[model samples]
Target: MAHAFDGKVAAITGAASGIGLATTEALIAAGARVVLVDRDSKALDAVCARLGANAIPLVIDLLDPASCNTLLDGILSKAGQLDIFHANAGTYIGGDLSETTPETIDRMLNLNVNAVMKNVYTVMPHMIERGTGDIIVTSSVAGHSAIPWEPVYSASKWAMTCFVQTMRRQLNKKGIRVGSVSPGPVISALLADWPEENLRKAKESGSLIEPKEVADGIMFMLSRPRNVTIRDMVILPSNFDI
Candidate 1:
């Protein structure tokens, strides 16, 4: 009856909803104690209550450098050690580049790029010192290609995709596994603001995936034996065209 993640501790950002929340549930089901990190206190509370005692809700904004410090400190203080870190917190801004405001650009880059870098930076030492850990970043299909519709978003994900790839090699000798899951489109808040026509088309064509499906991909990567590292996985809806 033993599970692959039994006795392990995981901290996931953006855990209040979407892929993050689904991953938390999957981890907990696999016997891992999870710390749900998100910026929404009320949503975090509701999710934790629904998830029961195994889920610990921690509301910390990933955009703030100090919050990253607080998150790591709080995780250690509460869970003692972190065996997995899912740097899945991110924001998306979709549209023509010319129409995007400078402030919006800054916000997207800060949350999608800077925040991810800071979280990994804050957690790497701990994982390295312990000589054991897994880091899975939620990237996007956009990262692997130049998406004209989401130029800035694609740039952010491209940065993460490269970062994860480089870190995997850099940390391999240190015993930490680094990887990324690039999903095409999922039924989550990330798509809530998508252009109506595009959203409708995706829905009608059944080209959107579920959060749990992406969670399953994450678990597959994490469940691999220590000697086996699934470096990168691009998961997309079977019927997705782009």
Candidate 2:
């Protein structure tokens, strides 16, 4: 009669808002103690308050590798084990090929690529030591199918997708389940700042997807038995032909 996630510890990045926050909520509902990670203290505090003491907040600027190590150490020290590692934090900036700044592109890669690697390195040791765990990386549809002007974002996601897939092959033998969730066009903070008319047009054109829908897909993947490893999953709106 034990819940699937009972007694397990989940470490999630970007737990302050958007898809990351939603994923944290989903895991908690399934009975896992969570380490809520984000750069924003106030937002993290608000999320932790709502989730109760079972949730611990660790503020980390994903751009800094040392900070990542410290946060991971704290989680493993406090929780003793890391049952689930969710690399679910990312950023985006949209502009034409000529309009994008070098700074914007660099920022996107730093957040989406380097920080993801930090999470992997942080939790991998514990998983390897225990010989069992689940690792889920939040990739994007852009990983598989590139957009017209989203070069850095596409490259970063593709890197994540590839890393997780390769990891599945390498880590499976170690009794670790590694997978990735590639969500397409989710209507979340990912693009909340865009002009309403532009956003509406994309939705009206049938390209927009939902955060909860994606979160549900993640929960489904995580709910599977230990022997079941979903190498990669791509969730696109019905409108996406491919």
Candidate 3:
């Protein structure tokens, strides 16, 4: 099938690893110019090298607006226009509700939730001016519902999910599309702290999903016909209950 991403521009967050990295590869393969933003400088450099000239690496601390501005400027300098913004960066933290510290809440919210909302608010104006653009935000299955140990993560994802839903209608008249994707347990070192036995059990159970699966889903949506849009898609492993 013809790839719809040819000559497009994409901005991705938390892009140095996992789903973000996978999505970068997918976009590049589809012939898109991608701006990869993340705090991980080493990994970001490696990804850019692997992707050659099609990708740009920006070491950004999403908590800092200055960093984001540098990213926007870099993209404009390189691509001249922003076509798709993939807000796919985040971290995972696990703790019980009562055990969750304020620091943890703030950190996760700042990186996972705050970065997403800020990116949308910052990027959409640019899209609005263009008259045709798309935003793909990554939420977790955890965000759609809740897990016993992940209260704040759930709240943050839910907030992002709701914001996208609300913005879709507002942005529809401008011919911009807003879509959200939620993935179930994805493999990452982010899961390292979990007890070894339980992690092994979960892996044995085949509940975790691969980064490529989520990335392909993103590419599929981007390649859809101009008038087609998916409000949101939840991707849990077939064996998983979510």
Candidate 4:
């Protein structure tokens, strides 16, 4: 039986854990060779080993402009052909913006917005040359709504929302599909700052989802027929509100 991703090559950033790792496992299960890109060498190596030969790990800090620019090129050289690119690497900064320092603001914006934009720009021509590819960026529910608690984080996602939608139109005729997976709070390290009581309450109230749920949403987006594009899929837990 042939799989949708058979013979395809995918490179996912922040692939060492959480949503990235879940998606990588999903893709590999579907027969795609995956390049796991992250800055943590130890975690990357562990995941690569656990996932076996199909999981290729590449360690690079997306925060650096030079590293971000060469991400796709490095993948192509290793994987030989790039068919899928998931820009899942990002950081979070919630709570009062007043307490957020300039450095913190810069880091969040750089990882969440700058790195994603640059990598997509870098990979476009290659995907264009092939005339086929899928570009999915991991966004947040905050991207579509004005979440006051995480104003700065929300702002970054809003930028991603605009970027993904506009890129979809721009690449429509070029045979490349651009989309975003916007997921509500999932159980991940990103929630480290959340108070333990709040986390417990959210989980008990069915307001939190697992990382695999988001990965499933991504799989749905990628598995759709090429002619059909799922521009944005907002995945949230059943009881999630506001």
lDDT of 3 by residue, 101-155 (tens): 7888888888787778778888888889889998999988887787877778888
Ranking by TM-score: 4, 1, 3, 2
| Cα error, candidate 2, residue 233 (Å) | 1.1
lDDT values, one for every candidate = 0.92, 0.83, 0.83, 0.93
| Model 3 ranges off by over 4 Å | 1-3
Residue 233, candidate 3: how far off, in angstroms?
0.6
Q: For model 1, how does the per-residue alpha-carbon lDDT over 65-134 read when each residue is reduced to its tens digit?
A: 7776688898888788999999998888899999799999999999888888888888999999999999
- In Å, residue 74's CA in model 1 sits off its true spot by 1.2
Residue pairs with backbone overlap in model 1? none
Off by over 4 Å in 4: none
lDDT string for model 4 (155-205, tens) is: 999999999999999998999999999999999999997878888999899
**Where is model 1 poorest over a 10-residue stretch in terms of lDDT?**
62-71
Q: Which regions in candidate 1 have their CA more than 4 angstroms from the true location?
A: none
